[model samples]
Target: MSRFVVTERAVINAPVEQVWEVISRTDRYAEWVDSAIEVTDHHGIATVGKTYAERNRTLGPLQTRSVWTVTEIDPMKRRVDTGVGFAPLQDVTNIFEFERTKGSDGGTRR
Candidate 1:
């Protein structure tokens, strides 16, 4: 298969720490993410070396379930890494990063 890089961003009206608190929870993905319909399965803290059991719909009638481990995490910079899918079959790695900038009005620049 071909490998391509993908980037995603979200804007939240909260502080970096505030956003981190919410985003770090793997079980709450269904609340914020569109694909993560349910956290059917998982093990892991919000930090690195944790694993998450997840079930998700990918496209029309396509879905996947697997143990996604926290491969890398940089909470200070709001970055994370997760590995998904059957390793011996198809491997999918997800890297999530957040940039927190300061706005002039003391708001978080998400």
Candidate 2:
């Protein structure tokens, strides 16, 4: 088996719910996700069993398309997706998490 891990962290200047709203919409992934090239078909809001077809840029000029299913979702907390067609990876999964940050003014930072 071959496995790899990629980690990215950022402080999005928005509230937790606001960020969740954007990430929950599978159809909008390609609009913000740098690696996603295009979404060919997105049924509806992300939910278990909901699937979407996406074209992703793996490395440089190499690209691949895959059908991803929403395997797990925790409302405004976490989301997990899994799919095949990633070649040597055979099975692949992606997880998205959101955390509320408190601002000095007693408001949510992001």
Candidate 3:
């Protein structure tokens, strides 16, 4: 098997606080994540050692269930989680980082 890492960055048109408010809730992923079909189980908050389960979309007309455990969190800054059940891709780690910035209009951006 091969190992690789994928990184993505986006400048959200919102403050870090606003973004964190949504992302900090593990149960809300299905609302925004395209691949997340539904949150099967979650505590409604993100905290180290907490776990959540989700039904996810895999490929064309394919789906799978995954369970994830929160590993690290930096309040309003970063979060990391490790997951299993997305077969052929073991030890999947998901990381989210937020940075506050000023938009072109001088408004908050994240």
Tens-digit lDDT track of model 2 for 14-81: 77777888888989999898878998899769989989988888877999887899999998778899
| lDDT score for candidate 3 against the true structure | 0.86
**Candidate 3 residues 1-110, lDDT tens each?**
77898887777777778788899999999998788999999999898999999999999889999999999999988899999999657889998877777555322333
Of the candidates shown, which would achieve the greatest TM-score relative to the real structure? 3
lDDT for each candidate structure? 0.66, 0.81, 0.86
* Span of ten consecutive residues with least summed lDDT in model 2: 101-110
Which candidate, 1 or 3, has the higher TM-score?
3
**How do the residues 1-110 of candidate 1 rate in per-residue lDDT, one tens digit apiece?**
87767776666667777777777787787788777778865443465777787677766778877667777777745455556674333566776666666664423443
**Could you list the CA RMSD of all candidates, in the order they appear?**
2.9, 2.3, 1.9
TM-score of each candidate structure, all chains considered together: 0.77, 0.87, 0.91
Look at candidate 3 and tell me the lDDT of residue 82: 95
Against the true structure, candidate 2 reaches a TM-score of 0.87
lDDT order of candidates, best first?
3, 2, 1
Error of 1 at 33 (Å): 1.7
What TM-score quantifies how close candidate 1 is to the native fold? 0.77
Error of 3 at 71 (Å): 0.4
Number of clashing pairs per prediction, in order: 5, 0, 0
